[model samples]
Target: MRRAPRIRLLLWHASAAIPVLGAAAAFYGPALERAGGAWPAPLDDVYIHFGFARAAALGHPFSWIPGNGYSSGGTSLTYPLALAPGYLLGFRGAWLGLFAALLACAALLDLCRSLRRLLEPRGGPGAASSRWVAWVAPLFVVAVPLLDWSWFSGMEVALLGAVLGRALVAVRRAELAPPARRPAEQLRAGLLAALLVATRPEAIALSAPLAVAVAHAAGSLGAAASLARASLPTALLLGAHAAANRAFTGEWSAAGAVRKLLLSNPYPTPLEKAVEVIKNLAALRVQALESALGGPWLSLVLPLLGAVAALDRRSRRVAVPLLLGAYGALLLVALNATARYQNLRYAAPSLVMLLVAAALGAHALARRGRLAAGVAAALAVAALAAPSAGFARQIDHFARASANIAGQHVEVARRLAARAPRPRRVLLGDAGAIPYLSGIPAIDGLGLGGYRGMPFARASVHGVPAVVELIERLDPAERPDVFALYPSWWGGLADVFGRRVDAVKIEDNVMCAADEKVIYEADWSALAPPGERRAGVIDEVDIADLMDERAHGYAFPSPRAGWVIGAVLPGGGDGAPRFDAGRLIPEGREQSFTVGAAAAFARGPAVLALRTDGGGPIALGVAALRDAGGEARVEVPERPAGRWSEIRVPLRDVAPGDRIRIRSLLGTFRSFHVWLLRP
Candidate 1:
């Protein structure tokens, strides 16, 4: 390859990568603008990477120990690895953006080079055919939807592609060389293979065939030596990382274990593990095949053609490594299939191999002559162009979503910062992105109240006493001033902080921002137990009694419209009735219930009141309550049947001062059940 052509190749590579770069910028650049100070979901990894890389740039060790101030222990190492180079270059967000662009460009360039090598050997008519194939190969590779999506994420797909491509080129070069000149060539091959291994752990599997190829090229004994030498650097790097992880987590394989836990736990039975592995493999196969075939049919066709081409004697060497990489990817996919996010990152190496195979197939077709080459080039270009178009649309959607999310995060961080006192611990339901954005020390909700020796063993040793001790040990000064709970975990916090003090700031559903610092001014002097602290719901509920009186009922009005009702009462006298539902129903609607004639209702006689939407006012009504020898019989009413209607039965009518269970057979009701108790 001459310098002029090489420069042209570089320029061509730049041109091919420009669209992807533009797409990434379109999707992620706006994210930076709207981020206020918060990062996006997939970018959680990126933010962690940024923190670690920033620390590294400032001459600090890249560790995940949070007490040290710049820890990424809870985060994956992918971001750190991807962002470290950019940070070292003194680049902030700009460097990250550029690094992403360059990795993509490198993938494109590798594709071009691989195509050129595969095509040139067929003794084509002129440079024009080779040039066409070279350019078209990358264009097709980039057009794959999977590759396009991978670019949007803060993953190293581009780098992975480059590494795999370089490994292939080195392998091909070593294989085709004379036997006498092979040893030195094999060393170079080993070095490239090592680089691949260092890029991603799964790359070892992806590059396995190439390792085998290098071994074969060197003869069995020489191959073993060559393989060991190639893997030495990777072994050392991983060994050091493992040692560090052991020091931190008390587990030599913490990195892998953490990754497994984060991705999917495979520690159950072998059958379960096998099922998970298969599912992931199937997904990767589908995605890879879909990308190669253009959309669906084309994806199948192109790969089949490539496979057919690989059947030729000259193509087997190339085919073997591609097959090995693909297999490795499938294995990884099976191991990590449940984790959709991680799957995308893990698929990078395999996609690189498929792109290589596709290029080779295109090259073989183009070998037939100008017209043949033109047709193949056109088909390849079309395959590439179509995905790029879809990828552009996805980038647009991702950009808008990311920007909106980022803006919301910034607002949340700013609000929390404003409300919180200095040096106060913030217990964030979602510690991710918030801590980095707000510049506050946040405690993990997952580790709240300390580990209590394993969940199952908490009651046997200390019971409520243990819980009380834990609460007492928790310093309010050290407790988070602002408790930010993501919508998913808001209920858990709500259980901890009672209603009067906990206020929800809802923009999105269930995402609540509560001020832990808010002190309620209650008339404690007038209480039955004067000066006694108010208890949370858990404290109020007598667990044994509550469990004993629990009744669950579910009704499906239609296939789509269904309702579930659950009631629990504390034992001894009548505890306050509680209702749990999948979703909250709006108030001021007629609610109906289907009471089976044979089924028992409330344990004791009860009073009921229909509370309003916000539990403000109560509507009083009546329902037939029969005492059936410890099994209460409640009959479905005729008036409120099949529609929304409210019926509240007083405690005096049923069992005096006892809680009753009621639910909507049809239509909506307020979020509460009938709580009949001594008032």
Candidate 2:
């Protein structure tokens, strides 16, 4: 028994990985350039890791903003650790992640070869033939858009692939080796399993089953040795991790887990999430069958693999497939329970594993008859090239979309940094790319970047965040020098940071710039009361409350707050919009709603200020009435439709004894607050 030549093994791995890397560089390099040099990751969350890695390299563990308290916001410990060195080396994370991905791809290729040999040992028929699973399966996996993106996106997906592949291969080696060699193999498997847990906590489910399988196969003595070797180091590493967590954040689990699992979590219970995971698996099963390989290949590949997994006890390939089934089930359960997408990168390992199995099955079928072999070859081609058309389309769309959204985030941060008197602390829900670009600390209003005891609770709906109470709940020390909000007119944030600073509009958002010294004076006022809101509608009086609120896009403070009546010419934008519903909705006609005033006080010196889209005149028409027989019109000024216009009318001309009648207001109304002044 001789080992394969080292160069041949290297070539095998390199052949599998290089093409994919070349393609990604060719595609995204230009795509990102066209997107104004945005980061290649499809999600802003990817930047958060870059930020965390930088912080960790600076001696702060798991922080988006170093020098601030530790934030357990990072989901996986191993990814940032791997990524940190790149940040310290002063290079783009995409390169380092790609390096990791290349290695993972190589591991996947090795696993594919191992699978091939397991199904068709060297003595078998057509053993000399090209192993389609080894040569072709990787192409299919890399071509899948989501898998491609995940591997390249600077997250843990590629690392997971490499680590999981190592674990599987090592466990198989442990099972097959003689007792003398089994202990070391088992120990390697154990260490890899520990690394998986350290990489992503959810891998525990997958690791546990692999350990049992390896231990069972290795016999009691080998198993005992394996457990000792595995457990001692793993326990120490885990203990150190827990100690780090406790030392910095006073908790054993990352604060991110709580942020993701409890506060701001969506799924109510484990059972419900398990149900969703099961459904997603079924959908994936259907998705694979419907893919380019189509029903014919699935009909052949699935049943064959199922039969082999069930009956062929000696084959090592089935062992991984079985473990994959368990891993995916549990991983999906954890992912879905945490309210993440069940079909995306979170479950990608499982999908790629099946692709490996399917590849083997397809190749093995080719061994039967000439007709069978021809059919297998054609199906293999289709599976590799055809189903990927859909995935290619998806990647293209993702590239464009990620470019715009992620590009804006980076650009805004860059713009902010370019300004005079750079803000050191900023707050926003979309806080991912800002710190990465600006090199400034950030307070994540969304709690994604690691904040402790943020001012919100979990909501019933998945992905829906809770309503924030007031500024007092937010520590004054953590108060940002720059406060920003999306859809700027929302009352919640306005209420929280009201009149304390000047807010300007930037890219459809409100950015409040604070003074360098004394961000807020000791003379700061108590937090204002929230707006009066009920049943999805917040009227003029408490519109400020709605503006200042920090609530999710669902529920009362959500985007669902709206109404549509006859065409009174409605107008709204990112902030709260306002509408003047006519008596009835007409297909295409301008109309107005007359709002009545209850009482009038004698007017001496007064002021009337109204906010309107100025879409139509008479946004607010007020008149003086003194035994008036005819209606009095103020000859309200005309204004344009889109931009908000402040209409402040002075009453110095009014007779001291005259009373005023409140007339109608106008525009597409989301928020219209009218204030009356008297002096």
- Top candidate on TM-score is 2
Tell how far residue 20 is off in model 1, in angstroms: 4.3
Cα RMSD (Å) per model?
A: 13.3, 14.4
lDDT of the candidates, in the order given: 0.47, 0.51
lDDT of 2 by residue, 1-679 (tens): 2456677667766776665656566446655654555455556567777777777888977767776556666767777777777667766543443444444455445554554344444446654453544555457556555556666655676676667666666767787788788888878978987887777666666666666667578675656656676455456667887887667554566555545543224323546545665665555454443442344454344334434343434443434544465445444434443334412545555555555555555655655556666776776665556455555555565465456444466556666676567775776663466677777677665555655534221211212112232223455554565654443322334333423343232232211121111121121123222333223221122222221222211112212222211111233332343322111111222212111232244434456555544444443345544434433334456677655555665545334334444444443333333444553
lDDT of 1 by residue, 377-449 (tens): 7667655554554555455544544444344444555565566344355554323445555666655444211
Q: How close is candidate 1 to the true structure, as a TM-score?
A: 0.60
The list of candidate 2 runs beyond 4 A from truth reads 1-14, 92-126, 129-132, 220-253, 261-311, 314-343, 360-379, 452-477, 487-491, 498-679
lDDT of 2 at 321: 43
lDDT of 1 at 400: 47
In model 1, which runs have C-alpha deviations exceeding 4 angstroms?
A: 1-14, 17-42, 64-82, 88-131, 176-188, 219-221, 255-294, 305-309, 312-318, 341-346, 368-375, 385-389, 423-432, 442-483, 487-494, 497-679
TM-score on alpha carbons, each prediction: 0.60, 0.63
